[model samples]
Target chain A: MLTAAPERSSHTIALVGLPNSGKSTVFNALTGFRQRTANYPGVTIAPFVGWVHRDGHSVAFVDLPGIYSLSPKSEDEHLAVRFLRGELPDAPTPDRLLVIVDGTQLERGLVLLSWVAPLHLPTALVITMIDELKARGGVLDVEELERRLGIPVFTVVGRRGIGIEEIRRSALAWEPWGIPFLPLPPDASVEERYQWARELSAAVLHFPRPDTRSERIDQVALHPVWGLILFAMVMMLFFQAIFTLAQPGMEALEAGIGWLQQMVENTLPEGILRNFLSHGILGGVGAVVVFLPQIALLYFLLTLLEDSGYFARAAFVVDRFLGSFGLQGRAFFPLLGGFACAIPAILSTRVIPSWQERLTTMLIIPLMTCSARLPVYTLLITATIPPVSVGGVISAQALVMMGLYLLGAGTGLIIAWLLRHTLLRGAKAPFILELPPYRLPAWRTVLGRTWSSTWAFIHTAGTIILALSIVLWALTEIPPVSVPPGTPPLEAQRLQLENSLAGQIGHLLQPLFAPLGFDWKITVAILGSFAAREVFISFLGQLYAIDVEAAEGTLRHVLAQTLPIPVALSLLTFYVYALQCISTMAVLRRESGSWRWVALALGYTFALAYCLSFLVYQAARWLLG
Target chain B: MGQTEIEVPLNRAPLRRQLVVRRYEGESSVIERLCELGLTIGTQLLIRRRAPLGGGIEVEFRGVRVGLRLREAAVLYVTACGDSNAYRSS
Candidate 1:
């Protein structure tokens, strides 16, 4: 352990369970919103630790990863076992442990119970999914199972928050340790476990007999071909839905921002403060307003998928394709979330076990059409690509939108393949999926998480970006233009941002960027956008406002009008291959242990962006000209 | 029939007899998982539904809904007894 807290207790309870066995719901039930501390070591798939009072004393319930055994193969599985064994930093072994099992599938869920019993960590069992067994025509001899295992068992329907009082009661009465002796002999290896799983299952489990029409249909649904297709469609629908539903709200936001900017303009004095408030603040802030709907919607959709168990299906579908590039099936969920933003997505990669796998997953996630890319795409598509109806079903612009998404996917795969072949070469992690059972989307859970994420984005735009915009405005506008007496000040030199420190620096770096088609103004915007992508829009907004003579839409129109098609295309391509967001870099620093990987990532991406953009522009013009 | 004999025995009149997965159609991460879960051709499979909407159908493998794409599902050869018993059926 690299660190431990000064006031830490020597006891921690790690909740272990199989997927969809109500591990999370149980945590929520026990925690009930009072949980704040993160449990998983180095995993941002951080589960909430809801403190419980057992018999007038405080006990912390740590929700560990959902796994089936102590014979750890994957990182999450290993972590779950390790934390229980008191290996993780500041993570202590439980005074009492709860082994949550599926009420319906005790045989399978008990796979872990049998393995971990010998290790002896104050074990008890909360058999979940009792409601489902009733719904699906299966019966559980709960008392018999509990007596045989020599542990207390409580039946729970975790979502309704049911049986939790009894759970608390058991926690209070728990011996602070348990000893479960198997009537049968124990096998140690995975090979032994596999055989034990079969033998033990035959002894205790009785699967609901499959006879009805539905069973046959499921056989096909599980089919590789059909399943893959369905998976693709689900993702396509999600992306299509995110963009589709966001447009109207996005338009309303644009109107609202325009109105707000006009209000600021009318109210403020026509000076540095006013320009800062109106053009710098409003323009920069307004760029994000158009994207709020998409961000909120994407977060909402992704949280639901992650919570409701559909992500597992989608992951299985793409697992094959991702494998070709050296990523595992687990990367699917992270990339799926990356479409909206990379913050949570990158954080989620902690659930990925291997550092190499996690790095590959993290690196590729930013490519999946993040909501940041939305404003740029919408701006370019509206300006350049005309939306014409194709075949009365597909919009030309929609097709182009699909192509852009595909391009991101293509680029991500290529990068992963490159990493696999070059810097990171090892056996691809074996695919292990914990397929959670189908369940209704937890609306409360989803909404709380989604809104929290939305609020985080809002907080970022309101603070960091807001402060930076003000600083940028000042950087571009200081020294109060001392013009020669009597000359209405040469309009160009009165536009003397050159006198300002920003313009001088922009001019200095102009030569290096010239080949990539970036003029001084574009270079300035690029530098500002390094802070945030949407800052590009405001960068142009503020730059043109500096020229004073440039009209509304003049900067946007300037790029469209004055810049060659090659330059505009180059800028677009540059953003397409743009590396991590600033926040992504910070998180990567925390995760990767050094800035070297971050620099390598940025250097490679920049070089890739420049070469790719140059080739694209030169080729497009050659083909057209 | 010869191909059917390659993996598992087919039911009489090609009834969709349950078979555990022997292996996946393609050697990918997904196929490997399906095989590990006793969802191969010989394992007893409960064919799920082709969702009324698009995407894929749901299948019950080792008592879980394994949602497979149309392409993957197609390679799966099954002996169905003219029953519409899809996955998720009561």
Candidate 2:
């Protein structure tokens, strides 16, 4: 909320760490709520930056992807190197780098410092996970290590916000030399550098008995049988948590959006413009926003698992399946995460050694049911499938929904199998994965990380959703034309939207859908819903907003008034089959660096959906008619 | 039911008893993966725990839970971690 341009006196600080090094937790503590999220050039991995104002200076702290070496392989790794080299788009090179190392893994994490030290940048080692180490009879001679390294090394345990302020102050106070982590003379081979680093570590470092929890956890968690069970149970719990806990909040959101639409209707002058804004924009776009709770909750649970070390074992559990699918075993984690959201999932696919596996995983990840699809599925199922009991143990409606989800998953797997033999077919890729030791769930770190990610979704991605909603609203509301209609559209279309251009287009698209049971109204809604799957509800909300059948239960009846039951089932089935998600497309473009793959995927899915729906509807009409 | 006592055909189901690895009994790509993880002879393995949806099995060895599919788990032999009923997964 600065009214004027702030002074360009802010200095950038990069926070670097090894995987699972608690660096992100400290970054969250320092930045709090001030941050920006965007994609790195030529890659999907989004780097984050946040501001911390201390004393009189604005300090911008950046969280870079964790890596073991300065050498680049993955796009994210390349971005890290480039940024360290003072080259990045939309970002000035950092003034200093903070290398955070896990104290328990000091031997391994210190390898990064040798590379960083020679660069000659003013660097500090934020020794993290110290609390875990201390509880396990481990102790670090921090002063001695600092004396040997000749850098201001701060001992930290950021999950609890401990030692965070100290590190920040030290970083703010330190002055830097011109050089950073430069290599030794050209005559010296890598062996010489390794020798020097090992000698230095031996002279200065102290390691008491390191915590063995990770090893113990790894033994049980990564075991051949039990580990797999625990991993699945954990993932299933996360999936179930989203559906179970986020429902009431979703209802509230739906109600709120509904109330707002009503408010806009009552306040605006009665015309196509007002009707279009309320029904088209608010209805079409607002529906997608309702899924924010589910998305946020999903991220919360995922971040929780990731902060703990259980996630690695889960990947280990599925490594064989990934290998069978012609994907690298490491591809399992990112693809599993793709079931939640594709952005982080695709970005994390960097662990895959080959581009083909990464591309294959990305192509099929959208086939996994994302939260965007959940809203539409819920709306449709509630409308069609009656709530009933099955042997008094299961909810019939719930079972059907679960079955549909399984169907999507099964089909996605089958599709991947087919693709492995066909279009992108290749020899199965090799696997190289790091199975890090497990740690206790740091709930504070999980919460902070979740909040940061959720904030990004709301501010950056959510705004794009909103803009699309507004444009969709205009499409459905303008034109003010006569409806050459056989069926009345949903509530959003009942307003003066009947005369708008969007309504006319919807009217025109009606016949293309009539065979599958939709009239002009449903056709219009589905057409705009192509941008996102879950928007089907809000699209209907906007479409139905203009109609009298704006209430929830009334929508199905309204559709039935136009098309037969067979057609409704066909539409539902079509939604189930077609890979209809905008986020999925964005991720595909990111992973492949080309839109061809996405276009091909979209074409194949839509073609398959239409063919299946057509056959199912026609067969049903012949029999059930 | 120990690795030394139970010697079933390589394709048949693994015995209920836990076993110590006498040796990796195959030479396919899958075996190469196991080799990469340093799963050699004298390694203790129990294949009782597994994921519900054909994900894999959990074998306890050197105090770590390693999840491997029956495809690979079949390659290991062992005595039961504990005396129990047959481990049948859904």
Candidate 3:
């Protein structure tokens, strides 16, 4: 046996568990909230790493991806096993292994531990969700479990902070950790290991009742007819709530920004600084931030659905439909998330167990017409389409907006099908999803997740959105035009924009976009929008310098007068199919660990956008003429 | 019909009825995954219900609920428990 003890000053500990085993809750409890996610070298997944300072000896806790066993079938499973065996490049082999198991399902947890025992790492067991187990009238003999496994056993109700500090103190005292006894022989077959785990768990645990509540819920949730109806109703209520609930908050934020802009205009001198502060900073970031209400609410409801265990049943219900399109039910989550923002949506795709399905979902997510597209769609539709009711029911503009959303989603499904058949064709991975027991979601965890995802959006807005806004401001305002003193301010701003560098580039690119009926000004907006779809509205607002609200009469009259019906229709079509978010592309690059998908996504989306827009423009022109 | 002749692939196993895992009839990798999840010869599983439009089967075993796609579930052959058809450890 090796005699060297782990360094006394610091230690690296790894946490592993099966999915939905409360591993993350324990990790959060141990590490607090100051966790940093680092992508493993050459891998598509990034595990959370955090540091806990105890008694002046800092312990770095690595929350490895959740897996059922150490088998290397899936990429996440492969990464976990590789990290455990010190085979993952650049990642330190953990000094000790912290295995987490669900208190309710101790047998399966023990089986997982059995898989890791052959490595002979100094290991300890953390049994989480003890509160839930006890609520079901289950009892666990923690001391007996420790004795049988020959390792330190800790039971934690991670949500309530019970038995957490003890784990932390034990982690700090790392040297005396026992080498966990192998639950089964190293060469034992899977069946033997499970039998051993069953016997061992039967000895140390007793549960008098089953999770009948989950079964009762699943009967309706997974029913052939009622399940679909419940799913549809849930989705409808969810989106309806998002729009209605977020409206007032959105208006408040808009008013808040307007108030701030007024203050900046009043305080700052009338020059580039004032214009930059009002239009460039507030206008750019504020436009994106205005949607935070919708995003936060969307994530909140999604967290509730997920924590209530309804999300898995929803996935099961939709599996056949998505499978027909070469996707899977788990793809539903990311696709739904796409309606909010593609960045977090792509991150959420980590739950998908298969690589091809996950990548397919990520690639097509931008086609879902994210919240960023709403402003653009609203601007164009209100400017062009009349508010007269279609068939005396839905307004024409609202109908058009709904049609655009359908077009985006339908195209995404078609593209997924095409890619599945051509580029990403592979045998479907077995879909084995564990339906966790239904419980009232912990409010703290739900709120924490919602806040973190919302924060991610704000981070994107601060960096990418703010940067793009500034760049567009520079491009449109540089080489200040020399207008006569009597020139009107609005006219002067337009002249400055037309004479700026962006104007020259727009003119240069006009011929390329002319087939889709885009003039140089619209071309400039499109070019700026390549960084972010929402940037198009800000760019157009700047180019027009129409101080009034964009959806109001003045800007609408200006747009309707400047562009014919055909051109307006074409631009709307282009926005529907275009992949307009560079931030999403960057995330794709990072997640896929290759620039190949990024290039393909950019290429195909642009081509599809151009062709579809050209066709719409020509068709509308012919019909109108 | 004799219980022995009524053995069927797990995908066709009757819903909410206890069935015994009889034989491994799937690819090795798939069988390994099933074993790891505690589905082994002679182990009993209760078929909870099929998903909407026959997408997958939810099986309950060892106090756990697991959903398996129809294709994946077809790999295991199971017989009704408490019968001669049920496999006995040799």
What docking grade does candidate 3 earn? medium
Better of 1 and 2 by TM-score: 2
Q: Candidate 1 falls in which docking quality class? A: incorrect
Range of the 10 consecutive residues with the lowest summed lDDT in candidate 1 chain A: A210-219
Residue-level lDDT of model 2, residues A272-359, one tens digit each, is 7777777667775565567677767877876777677666566666766666766655666566666666555665676564567777
TM-scores, each model vs. reference: 0.76, 0.79, 0.92
Per residue, candidate 3 scores C-alpha lDDT tens digits across A296-383 of 9988888888878888888888888898889988889789878877877887787777889888988999898888788788888888
The digit string of per-residue lDDT tens for model 1 on A1-625 reads: 6676333333456788876677767766766655654534554334446677644566678877776556454556666777777766666666667888766666556666776777666677887767776766666666666667777777888777779788876665444444776654665543344445456554444545533433444344345577556667777889788878988998898788889888987898756677677757876677555667877788788767767666775666566667677886678778877777676677678767667888877777767777777676666655555457789999876876677777887898898898888888876554445446556766655655555556656654445555565666677677667656664333433365555667767778878778787898877667666656877766565556634345445555554555576676677787877773676676666566579878877887788788977787788678768
Find the candidate with the highest TM-score and give its number.
Answer: 3
Candidate 1, residue A441: the lDDT equals 68
Candidate 1 or 3, higher TM-score? 3
At residue B31, candidate 3 shows an lDDT of 86
lDDT of 1 at A206: 50
TM-score of chain A of 2: 0.86
